[model samples]
Target: MKVRFYFITITLACLVLTACNPQTNQIEKTQAPQVIEWEYQIAYQRGMEAVTWSLPAVSMICMRNASFNLGGGYNTVYWLSEIPTAKQEALTANNQTPYANVYLNTKNGPVVLDIPPASNKTALFGSAVDIWQEPIADIGPAGADAGKGGKYVFLPPDYDGSEIEGCINVPSGSYQVFVALRCIPIGGATFKEAAEYAKNINAYSLAEINNPPQGNYIDIAGKHLPTLPDYDFSYFGYIKELMDTEPLQKRDMVMGGMLASIGIEKDKPFIPNDKVKSALTKAIADGYNYLEYMFETPGFSLIKQWEGRQWMNIREPSNDGFVFDEGEYLLMDERGSLFHWATFFPRHLGKATAYLNAMQDADGNLLKGEKQYKLTVPAEVPARDFWSVIVYSKKTKAWIYNDLGRVGLSSYDKENMKLNDDGSVDIFFSETAPEGMESNWIPTNGEDFFLLFRFYGPQESYFDKSFVLPDVQLLK
Candidate 1:
């Protein structure tokens, strides 16, 4: 029978949904409880859990797959010759700097990432993450290489390699890894100069270390790179590929069984029946909604960055790396929430940068592109390099589509920006430039949008909560 056909085979004694009323914060009997098919319910619930557990893995593989589609394979750098725009199509990606990435595979032996030292004040920022999206190590001055630059090696899971040295040896738990780097123009360097310097980044297998292979770099500047995870059946396919390639972890054995219930197994061929596919199809859609709910819910993970403000920190204050290991158990929801909308976190929390999320105005209303909002950046931002505010569609968690090729405003645009007498700049967000504020404005495409304020080289005042960013006020 079809999956919906079983929906009619409902039984009594079970509520259709056990949701509490938001206003009352309590369960009520005002509505009658409905019934659901037992077998379908069991499978659907398991499918939801599978989506949550496998989010990071699926997101990582999405980047790898998209890279391959762009004619770049494993251990080849995909560097950008210019800043990203809407066409880049990565989740919560910024237009602040040029991105450089390398998809690494170490099943055979080990892979090497040779990052060049900072020159002319241009440096790389970001981390080398595994298939799980967990940082194997941070990559810049604030990271393992300490900006001096050196050879970094990624070893396959449990590889019996003899004494590894002279390089940052990152032991991986999976065969798939990716190095995500952003080239920043620091100390009066030009963006064009920084983009050119990113070419020095190289990735090759350990065997090719002596004679590193050349000319595999694919420039993704202003190009369409589809790297965002989707709520489709193919999402599970990515997870399965990861499972098949990665050595099984003791902690994931239970999750492995859950995935099997939905016809996704590591070693076995996947052939889901129509009935099973129907359940999973619905599960992914609902699971995405659940993640959105979690992101907005209070006391979940979005902690207010400034005192009594609506702006929130993207990741909760936790130990660096976002493992969410809380001694007795893991914070699955917390960890999943981070990867759900964003990607590539540093191993050290706020070591090189800080991110603050803005979804609502000074009042508690959600931000809409039809309405205009203005945020007053403090006269002295703690960012040493620059501070940027970018907008993304809240639904897609990606750049808002626009014809102007504009998505953000940063301190780098000060030449055009109109700053107040005190040096504080007022940044505007709306469908069109708010009267005469073109230079300090970002478009939101008349859709439900959110903001991410970034601080490159965050200073002591930022960490100590002294440099507080004010809330965005509605333009009345």
Candidate 2:
């Protein structure tokens, strides 16, 4: 009976798909509420999965009673669908925790690989996580050889003493290794949740690395990978259906679509089934109902709360002095802020905005409050492109009011900005415009705001830590 029902439903859905009119077939209100609700939940969940680790061009994070989407930071996210097999093995074999040395057991004891310069800037198993590899036929085990399996592992930083005795096995072929000195910084409860999240995400990332879709690979490192496949798109249709009818499912649908958009899409339509038609016009009407729900309770509810955080344990502090031990919130910053946060939408959802706003500094100043920030681009930032800083509202988690709906200030504004005596540049931010800084002023409207610092054509100064940003503090 259930099978029969599904078949009927799918057939109807297919018919609906065929009849869909690009111009006039939109879902409507006062329609099949039950079916719409169900579709929305399914769409939202799937959409979230597609984008959980995929990078985006811009993303929102609830910070200080406002939405803080890292619009232009300097890192990226490699979705599992986008990784290559060879890199997966490299990432596995090269996995190293803090303070652990690789050893080869000769009868006279173990000899480690020639220790390279701590400044080599090469990961111990760097090549493995290269996001480069040939397609693999079998994903589980490569060959009969245990060593050849090329299985990757991530150990906590504090695995010392007895934990070091056991050797990790790998394929017998000659191999090179790189170590990633990476750690995550997050609150306690959030970290724990993120770790579990990471585990699921890692599975997806590895899957992509092992068997990327052919022709889906984007050009990188002077080569092309056919491994990364476009994200599953049926979910969008599901969201559209849900949004039209189900109120509770509205937030999840939007969240899901936003998340899925973070991964490889190959120009696929961002909106749900632009090609489908609906026989039950009532169902189409449901979409209107869903949009209405988006404006109501928990529709755009920005607060996300955790009993505490969950993340990997910190073995050592990062270059930024933030401890990244085991079981703490771990976020990858290799991709610029915009890309990384965009894919990890779940991290910024729920009570996150409320929590950020809750951080008060005792004198009643907002913790990480809005301030008149002075930004100047020295002649030396790195990248092939330009950069920008934009702000969003905490309560709404959307880009705040913009005269031109611009998200942030960008290098595109360089010619329009005031120049400095030394060839550097300057920009300002504040709740109220300062007396003489109108040209560079970014208005805050007395609300919380996040500043994203970006540098295009970044040079050695960026990689070598010669450039740093002043803290975001409140101004009198």
Clashing pairs in 1: none
lDDT for 381 in candidate 1 is 94
List where candidate 2 sits over 4 angstroms from the true fold.
1-341, 344-371, 403-406, 456-458
Return the top candidate by lDDT.
1
- TM-score for each prediction? 0.89, 0.28
lDDT of 1 at 119: 78
* Global local distance difference test of model 2: 0.30
Backbone clashes under 3 angstroms, per model:
0, 99
Q: Mark the 10 consecutive residues where model 1 has the least summed lDDT.
A: 11-20
Tell me the whole-model lDDT of each prediction, alpha carbons only.
0.82, 0.30
